[model samples]
Target: MVKELDEKIGALPDHVGWRLWRASRAWQAEFSAAMRAAGHAWFSEARAGLLGHIPRNGTRQSALIERSATSKQAVQQLLDGLEAEGVLERFPDPRDGRGKLVRYTRKGLDALRDGDRIKLEIERDYIDRIGRERFAALMDALRSLDAGPADASEEASVPE
Candidate 1:
């Protein structure tokens, strides 16, 4: 069944969006596998998205919802799971008494370090396979396509 779907999709017209989606999917799988190998067996591509939006000092729950481009309920569910796993904690927002701020636990910070290191390693692998010049061109082209990434930048989340 999967092979049949693959054949059908493969027969369809190829375009930039299709290629990008396929590439992203492949990369995500590789990243998840790498995380598991690095002793973070609970890590996954979805959790990575949640983790990426968290800053060192922490951000409000509403801010996480906005930055992650996800529903408030969805963000809460993710937060609840992470909290259960001891990866993060939620605190009452001082500025807004009714609001909540989410911050990483010690475990999460350690995982972030591993994530950053793994990301760099992945980039080096891509450079070796595609050549540095070609990889640089690819990055430039990708950046040109979008206005810019979301206000997802917190600090040290993305590799230099």
Candidate 2:
């Protein structure tokens, strides 16, 4: 699959492939800046949203950290800021009083919802520019790439 993708990429026009790669980073910066300007900055929006999905008061902070793919310290920092902003609250885990559980406040849920709406709007605009067929193909290709086996693991396991 990697070889096939490499061949396809190799066949792309130099300018097109280069611009596609460059545009991804450029778009990320633009989107992050827009989110910040809209008072939804920080990578924790997705993390907070995921936390919201879990049963409140029953979910543990460690679970949230794992699902968010962020370090415990980083999650704690984001949680602290969110708590200060009244977006979420931390409580002692009933299962283990020493452990903490995080839950989103009404404000936090609202913020997450608003940020998602904005992201959808931005994506819609980009898709509109790309046109439906092209956008569909691009999305399908990206999803296929994402679903493929871990290339890094395969490479590491190969005989030297």
- lDDT by residue (tens digit), candidate 1, 50-122: 8888898899998899999998888888888889888899999998999998998988888888888988999
Using all chains and alpha carbons, the TM-scores for the candidates as numbered come to 0.82, 0.63
Off by over 4 Å in 2: 1-24, 39-58, 150-160
Deviation in Å, model 1, residue 142 alpha carbon = 1.1
> Number of the top candidate by TM-score?
1
State residue 126's C-alpha deviation in candidate 1, in Å.
Answer: 0.6
Clashing pairs in 1: none
Which residue pairs collide in model 2, if any? none
lDDT of each: 0.85, 0.69
Clashes of 1: 0
